[model samples]
Target: MSRTLMSLVVLIVAVYLALCAALFFFQRSLIYFPQPSAVNSADSRLKLAMPDADVWVSTHERVGARALIYFGGNAEDVSRNVPEFAAAFPDYALYFLHYRGFGGSGGSPSEEAIAEDALALFDQVYASHPQIAVVGRSLGSGVAVRLASQRPVQNLILVTPYNSLEEVAVKQYPWVPVKWLLKDRYESGKYAAHLRVPALLLAASDDEVIARDSTQRLLENFPNGVATLKIVPDSGHNSISERREYWRWMGDVLNR
Candidate 1:
């Protein structure tokens, strides 16, 4: 091949690789961004209300053992889990937070924005309820860890979480440069390590999307002597809630 032609071809290949990397790192924005839609919770038995910033909350009871706030996965409605949570902690009040653009909430969704919303919700909930616990699954883990680090939380629970979305992107697209390209660095792993409250980290053995090691990385960040790590057998990323042991484990944790 001629020298000029060879050089041009190499340059084109490099540009293509760079573009692929950009797309890979920001893949979640490309994949998970969806317009918020108002979902009907009229039939829900739990008392529903929106106190701030396009977020919806479901409460089981005002007077209970403790208040529980739940953050859900990227595609999770979260309100759907109200019944299950109420069943699990019937005495304690249950709260579900809708992300900026998830489930009829206003504004666009971003990692920092969601974390701010979580902190606001935590503050609002904590103002009245002294005993507060935070629970998060998947993408919501980012919000949970951030809130725990910022606030005085009684307990923290993370399910099917990753160290960071950026890390996950790199794993999914090894050819891509995720570190520089990702706009939303949901670095839950970085925050989880410093939490002082009791923490529960749950990993799925059969999670095909997020590896167990990634979840372990988040667990490792937890401060010494206060973390409980559990691996659920035969459970995938989405099926952790379906397992009977999940409820039993949570009951034990809360009781502890």
Candidate 2:
């Protein structure tokens, strides 16, 4: 090769490698977008004392055996769901977890750390409310799926869930080596296979964030008859919950 051509080639390779290095080092920032909690009243908040972090849960207390635990999207403030969820499921106690570093929670978030916190939350909630139903939306879907797999959850609800975070990352950054660079691969599909309870997977008809194929792939992982997929009509990924049918479907699963 000519000297000029060789230098250009070297420069291009260096730039590509630098990009890869940057992605590897700062990938979590791309994955998690922490948001502040909106509802932070003393009565509604639950402080979960973890070894590394103090996680906060937005709760609606109800004296009953049934309860619903929610995990929100990466950038979502789960506390925002409080009023609607309280009115919709009045019989069931509601708990919406604000992930580590999200809302008022301390410490950084990772797949493993969030998983541990989820399990802890379940254990605590399950003490009084044995008939626990878990709901996870977007990124929280992965956390909920994994939690249901390990815990004796009564029902599982996944909203706009993908097969795996790695697959989504791969599609998002087609040029980058996402599989190798990803540190927190939330493989919901892998855990879905272990779930024995009833599961409801809610998909948006016009979801641009999570591909339809990704939701389908995750549904395929579940055992036959254990899970069902329902697409909310005329809705997008973030707007799925706005539809009345979305709550209806969720109510059907949780109530059953």
Candidate 3:
């Protein structure tokens, strides 16, 4: 081998290693986008105690056994959904969870930490409300899936959910060995076969974030009749909830 060719090969290897190292250390920053709170919590928020941080949940107070627990997107401020949920289901108490480091919640966000906080919230909600519906969107879908599989969740709702974080990460970073590098693989598909409760998956027709095929693949993971997919036309991943029909569908699902 020529000296120049060997030097070129060495440079390429060094660059590849640098990229891998960067991804390994800063991967969480790519996954979790913790945003500040826009909604005032003085009127309606619940502080769920956690060792790492206090998780803030937007609460729609209602005296009933039927309640809804919502887990939202990575960058979403879940407090934004509180009003809509209150209007949609008057009888049901709504609790929208803010992932760690997001909204007013403290502590760095990770798949494991968020899941633990979710489980804590579920346990507390379940104790008071015997029949609790768990709703998760995007990143939260994985947390909700795991929670539902472990708890006796009455209804499970997934919005723009993917089969696995690793799968989605691989698509986003085609050159990266995501499977090996990823520490928090939210593999919702893995829990699908174990779920017996009815699940509703909301998909966006023009979703630019999560692919339609990814949502479809997640539905396929569930057992026959275990889950149903509803595609919101002319809506992308983020705007699907903005559609009027979206609330109507949600109302019908929760009411029934």
Which lDDT tens digits does candidate 3 get at residues 1-256? 9999999999999999899989999999999898877786576888998986888888887888999999999889888888888888888988888888888888889988988998899889888899899899999899999999999999999988999998889889999888889999999999987999999998888999898788888999999989999988889989999987678777778998
Order of candidate numbers by lDDT, starting with the best: 2, 3, 1
Cα lDDT, all candidates: 0.77, 0.94, 0.89
The window of 10 residues in a row where model 2 has the poorest summed lDDT is: 247-256
Give the Cα error of residue 75 in candidate 3, in Å.
0.5
lDDT of the structure predicted as candidate 3:
0.89
Please say which candidate is ahead in TM-score: 2 or 3. 2
TM-score of each: 0.87, 0.99, 0.97
Q: Rank the candidates by TM-score, best first.
A: 2, 3, 1
Q: What tens digits encode model 1's per-residue C-alpha lDDT throughout 1-256? A: 9999999999999998878876856666763644433345554322223344555555455665488999888888777787788887876677787777677676667777777777777777777788898898988878888898899999888888888888888887687666767788888878877778998888888998888788877778778887888988889988988998788888877655
lDDT of 1 at 241: 83
What alpha-carbon RMSD in Å does predicted model 3 have with respect to the real structure?
Answer: 1.1
Segments of candidate 3 deviating more than 4 angstroms: none
Backbone clashes under 3 angstroms, per model: 1, 0, 0
